[model samples]
Target: MAGLITCLSVPFLSYLGLRSLPAQETAPRTIVNLEVIVVDTESKALEALERLKKGEKFSTVAAQMSIDPNAGNGGYVGEAEVASLRPELRAAVESLQP
Candidate 1:
């Protein structure tokens, strides 16, 4: 009986050592919708860059022509920065194209 308990206890102790919780990797993820529109031309893009250099905010211009339904009201890009913004949206904002 003692030997039986010892054998059973060994398995229980082994289980205690072997059992483990899964390791989770938490990564930063920002979700964004993929819809975007391209501005007309390089000249338009350059003009917007000039405006930015002149101390203008890109969002203000984007609000007028973003092609998103909210553009007229406000570009309202939410939390995105230029570098992280949707490619076309960034281009359109910078270009301020009609």
Candidate 2:
């Protein structure tokens, strides 16, 4: 009776674990260079966006406007996984051409 109950429980437990996972079965795996500019306020974020639109060097803009500790390193975030990124950033990355 114990062996029969154990076999029945295993499949149910597996199904529950699978259901708890993210719905996005396959996250983007390719690595891409990402430029980031983190600012303290909405106004600052707008300013950084304007700089990017003007074709300013991303690293230079990042160094000047970003308050992040790694601002000096040109804001190079290196390769990243889409699943690990915030929703906004993930959308940006998804828009890029492969």
Per-candidate alpha-carbon RMSD to the true structure: 15.0, 10.7
In model 1, residue pairs whose N, Cα or C atoms come closer than 3 Å (at least 3 residues apart or on different chains), thus clashing, are: none
TM-score of each: 0.37, 0.60
| lDDT of each residue in 1-98, candidate 2, tens digit only | 35542211112237447333334344447666776788999999999999889999989999999988769988876777676788988898888887
**CA deviation > 4 Å runs, candidate 2:** 1-28
lDDT (Cα atoms) of all candidates against the true structure: 0.53, 0.76
TM-score (C-alpha) between model 1 and the true structure: 0.37
> Least lDDT summed over 10 consecutive residues: which range in candidate 1?
4-13
Question: What does candidate 1's lDDT look like per residue over 1-98, in tens digits?
Answer: 35542211112236447543433443455444333222567776666567668987766655543556656544553555455766876676566533
Model 1 regions more than 4 Å off: 1-23, 28-38, 68-70, 79-98
In model 2, residue pairs whose N, Cα or C atoms come closer than 3 Å (at least 3 residues apart or on different chains), thus clashing, are none
